[model samples]
Target: MALDIIAALVYGIITIIGGIIGYINASSNISLVSASICGLLLIFAAFARLQGQTWGLTLAAIVTAVLLVVFAFRLAKTRKFMPAGLMTILGMLTLAVMIHQFMALRR
Candidate 1:
């Protein structure tokens, strides 16, 4: 459970860093702004989970699943071991850990 919480925080921080980089590279793009907002939400969700909020984990699960699909598509199209591939792999591992923790809670 502690590991899951830490992973969730790492996930959120990585996403925010990516968004900041993207925004710096493309200042005029609306998408970067949207991405940054989503990243901020992820950070909030992580904090919420840290405070024992059940909805936080649920929200993180949904966000990570979406990110996994996006990264998977990018990896498939490029067919290389790039950032997309790396993130996709991490997202899968994190998602698995999250699911296992949730299952334990149910029992």
Candidate 2:
């Protein structure tokens, strides 16, 4: 749970930073708008997890886990060791945390 919260917070912060950068550098409004939305959603998801919304967190974790697995596998097959390893570790950690939370909620 702590790990999930921390990861979400980190992700939110990164997204918000990216959004600010996009707004400053991009002439088109669409990129900035999309970044802002992404930032907001990341923050909202973080807060939801903090509040013990197991269902939402589980869904998000599952999707992210699948994406991470696919990314890792592709990278590994291409011999991109660093990124592949990092993604695999991150995906497994997130999946484990979310699954634990989900099981606890079910009980």
TM-score, each model? Answer: 0.83, 0.58
The predictions' CA RMSDs to the true structure, in order, are 2.1, 5.0
For 1-107, candidate 2 gives per-residue lDDT tens digits of 56666665564465456556656776647646654665466567668878877655755565556546665776769776544565466556666776776676679
Which segments of model 2 are wrong by more than 4 Å? 1-3, 11-43
- Over 24-103, each residue of candidate 1 has an lDDT whose tens digit, in order, gives 77673654665566566666777888889978888888888888898799799988765578879988988997898789
Per candidate, the number of residue pairs that clash is 0, 0
Clashing pairs for model 2 are none
Lowest summed-lDDT stretch of 10 residues in model 2? Answer: 10-19
lDDT of 1 at 23: 67
Worst 10 residues of 1 by lDDT: 28-37
- Name the top lDDT candidate: 1
Query: What TM-score should be assigned to candidate 2?
Result: 0.58
Model 1 lDDT, residue 94, Cα: 80
